[model samples]
Target: MRIKQISVSGLFGIFDHVIPLNMDERITIIHGPNGFGKTAILRILNSFFNSQYSELRAIPFKHFCLGFDDNTSIEIIKNTDNSEEAEKNNIVFKFYQPYSEPVYFYLKPRKIRSDRGFPMMFLDYGIEERHTPIIRSLDIRTEETLFSEEAVEHFNNLSFPNLKSQEEPNWLEQLQSNIHIRLIESQRLLNFVPNRSSRRSAETPSILSTVSAYSDELAKLMQDKFKEYGTISQSLDRTFPVRVVKQQPSTDLTDEQLRHQLNELEATRSRLIEVGLLDKDEDAEFQIQPQDIDESTKNALSVYVQDVEKKLSVFAEIASKIDLLRKIINNKFAYSYKEINFSKEKGFVVTTSYGSSLSNSKTLLPTDLSSGEQHELVLLYELLFKVQPNSLVLIDEPELSLHVGWQVQFLKDLQDITQLADLNILMATHSPDIIQDRWDLTVELKGPHK
Candidate 1:
């Protein structure tokens, strides 16, 4: 979708604004000096395209645009053959707002003939994705209606709740998981572990002492590779590789060898106890026999089993998508082409120009790749996602963690890809190097350009 015009009565410092986007150019650059409300422009455009529901969260009261008291109007649509007919466009978004008292926030492409009569045909571009019938998640089970309440409810109940009903179901699920994973991964879990000194207690290490202690401990842990040790612990706890043959302890074992022997033995004993090999009396307990189900409980059990089965089905479906995504990513970025390999352990692994794994060690993560490679991989995947022709693409901050040379080269390559895919990319960037040649479409952001 392309935006034709955007007008804001009051937003940020702007009292009244009108910006007509040129659709002929593939890219449109909003050039303004620092503190000239360039970022505000992007936000306005984003708010315009996004649902009113979304806008409320971003800036409530309809008249309030973040720091500004304003009413905003945006017009977006496919350019038709007849401009006169387009002027009388039927598009409208009207909905109820719990935040604002009494009535719904009314929006229409054209001024209504009468305030009393509201058009039903116009799409409701509420922040809630479910507000629009066209944008709602596809429900293959029901064809009678465009909007499936049952499907929506079922989707709402997913592990990842749908923030917007209009979003594709799988998209919501993946998005939730992605956000969860990112949050958990981004947390830099730092702590002070007191040194093994007699005077240094866990609770009372001084700031300087704590830093020194943590560094010493971290150094030793890194040298010993505690991550591998943790992996072993997890494997043992999970009973992975369920059975193992025990190797007899050697008579000439060293201290390290003895420690390994004891750990292995302890792990075996724990597994044996879990498997019902030993009771509290040091006697072996046989597996218990299955009990017969009663008629009443049998029906309940069946229902309970069905519920569990459904949960499992949801999990299996999500896992399948992740697996499929991983496989596709791997094949697409394999050594032969982009030289990026994907592993659940490594994420996206960038191979060296010499065809070696980017990480020197097998145990090291794929995220260990240089910033340039990571940015390239991110760009590659984002572009690859738009398979459909004439698809609208929204990219926030396209110039993330990349050198100027790479950014220029990447943009040049992306232009070629966009041509093939027939994709219209609406990218937000602060890089002059990337869009310098396409200056007409470049929008300078507020703040120091660097």
Candidate 2:
């Protein structure tokens, strides 16, 4: 269900572009001059798949098409020439398959109640004039004179029951369901969240808050895994006596093999402790010698080894993610004299190595990091923890707030993330350092020829 090709006609009523995704690399970079609709294309793709129909109506494009790897395609056609009264039914969605006839769907715009003025949420937040640039850039249009551009943008991003039709076709629903898309916009720092006291009221929190929230979430996840490990240990310990007594010793079961298995189990436990999934054992230094294991003790030792392996297997998935996150974060943060370590109680323990002694070292809060550091951490966290496998992630400007050195290393970090997360990336960037020598992976959006 991966999108193989994307084509748009009459983008801003001037350019027509075709972008072929780099399936082999699973990372495609869209780079072009300003006003070339690089960000618009990404937004449209995200809007359509995410059911944000207002964005499609706002952006001035005649036709947009997506070709999938399964030999099926979906096309969106807009008729802007129609009168204002007839414009509600102007947008059309067409799905094309190999053998079946093309399916057509007419998208009807949601009608606003003029008597209601504007949503109270917008008024409370104070839709200032500063939002004009975002509205103009996004090309949001609303017929209501009272509705602010920021209000329209907010309404478009939200999931409203009245905005979507109740009678959606099964094929269209299935198509949209199969494709998963996440858009990470350039303005990634601040997050608009609803207030706990009232659902209608919302507050804007900085990325620092988001980083702290994710840290707490990761800590809870680690605690949950530890609890599962404990539960498994209890169950295995209960059944161990019976299982070991019923076990038949094999001729091939040598003491050396038993000792090797025990050593591997110890290594796994040590790793679990390293990743913060398990606590350090007081008796971790204890080891079994060959002379200590007789025929009868061998059977019990083998069973014990199997039980411990089963218990430790619970931490495998979370351990790998935490390990990779620590490695990447530490590698980048080391330049700034910072180190990141995990704790079962605290999600991320970020410390600075500024003082002469360990006692003088400073433990900084998540908000204490610079903008670039926060951006890197937030972006990586979303890719690794937030997104599901085989999803398409659209990053508007990954190079924002990043230093040249970090920008150059961005692609390599993304490659590692894609391999671990099993994701496909389609990012639009202006920085050449982000692209580096991998221009072959880029699709340039050009204007009409002279």
Candidate 3:
């Protein structure tokens, strides 16, 4: 269900571009001069799959098509005719598959009366000025635009009813369900969250808050895994004696094999403790002597090893993600004299190495980090913790706020993340440093003449 290719015609009424995703690499970079529609393409894909229809209607493109790996394609056609009647049924989505009839869906237009007066009270509202047909026809007191494109769209959906039912066809719905898309915009620092006390007003929180929240989330997740591990340990401990009594020793269960398994389990436990998933066991230093184990004891130890492995398996996925995050963050933060450590109580414990001579270190808050550091941490955390597996993540301006060194390393880090997270990345960037000799992965958006 992966999108193999993306094509758009008459983008900004000037350019047509075709972008083929590097399916094997599972990453695609789109680069071009400014206003060449790189971000718009990402937005269009996100808008279509995420059902943000307002964006689709706003972005100027005659036809936008997504070709899938399964030989199916979806084309969105916008009627360019300027007539009000034609504008009512402006957008049509067509889904095509080989050896099957193409399915068509019309985007139902929101009906707003022409004589409706613009609400003067919403003048102070932070809405953009792109007027849809519904808003354009409204009678206004002032010449200045009242709302942003997105704000206008939101208002229209709330104020007006559709001419017909807005229900999508089952096939279209199922097709959309199969593919997942996440857009990580360039403005990554601030989040507009609804005010808990009031629905209408919203609070803008910085990325610093996001990093702290993620830290707490990771802590909670680790605690939950520990609880699950404890439960599994108890369940296995209850059945251990019975299982050991019934166990039959075979020639395959060698002494060396048993010792190796025990050592591996200890190693796994040590790793878990290091990653903050488990508490350090002070009495965990005992090692089995080869001579001390008889046939009966070997059987019991084998069962014990299996049970421990089962318990530790619970931390496998989260441990890997956390370990990678630590490695990447610390590697970069090292240059800034900072270090990141994790704990069950604290999501991220950041300390500065500046006071080494005084034998004292300051524990800085997440917000204490520089803008670039915050950007790096927030972006990585979102990739590792927030996004689901096998999703298409559209990152706009990944090079934002990153140092040139960080920018150079961005692609490599992203490659590592894509492999670990099982994601397909399609990012737009202006920095050649971010591309860093991997121009082979890029799709350049050129003008009609170029």
**Candidate achieving the largest lDDT:** 2
Worst 10 residues of 1 by lDDT: 179-188
Q: Which residue segments of model 2 deviate by more than 4 Å?
A: 113-166, 195-208, 282-292
Candidate 1 Cα outliers beyond 4 Å, as residue runs: 15-18, 31-54, 60-338, 341-349, 353-364, 386-388, 443-450
Task: Report the lDDT tens digits of candidate 1 across residue range 1-450.
Answer: 244444444344343444444456554444445445444445444433333223322321123211111222222222223577653532223222235432222322322133223212111111233433221232233322223332233222121222233333342233223211100011112222222232212223233322223224323433233244345445543542232222232336344443343344444434333322222233121111124334333333333332323322322322332233344434433443344333322233444443455554243234544444444444554444323455444554555665666666656666665665555555555667777677676644433225
Winner on lDDT between 1 and 2 is 2
Evaluated against the true structure, the overall lDDT of model 3 is 0.79
Tens-place lDDT per residue, model 3, 117-184, is 54533322222234212222112454334333423554432223221125788888788779988888
Give one digit per residue, the lDDT tens place, for model 2 in 74-120: 99999877798667678899999999999999887655444444434
Give all candidates' CA lDDT scores.
Answer: 0.37, 0.80, 0.79
**C-alpha TM-scores of all predictions:** 0.37, 0.86, 0.85
Clashing pairs in 1: 28-441, 29-441, 29-442, 30-443, 53-127, 54-127, 63-70, 129-166, 130-165, 130-166
Strongest candidate by TM-score: 2
Tell me the deviation in Å of residue 265 in model 3.
0.9
Residue 319 shift from truth in candidate 1, angstroms: 23
Checking candidate 2 for backbone clashes, the offending pairs are none
Mark the 10 consecutive residues where model 3 has the least summed lDDT: 156-165
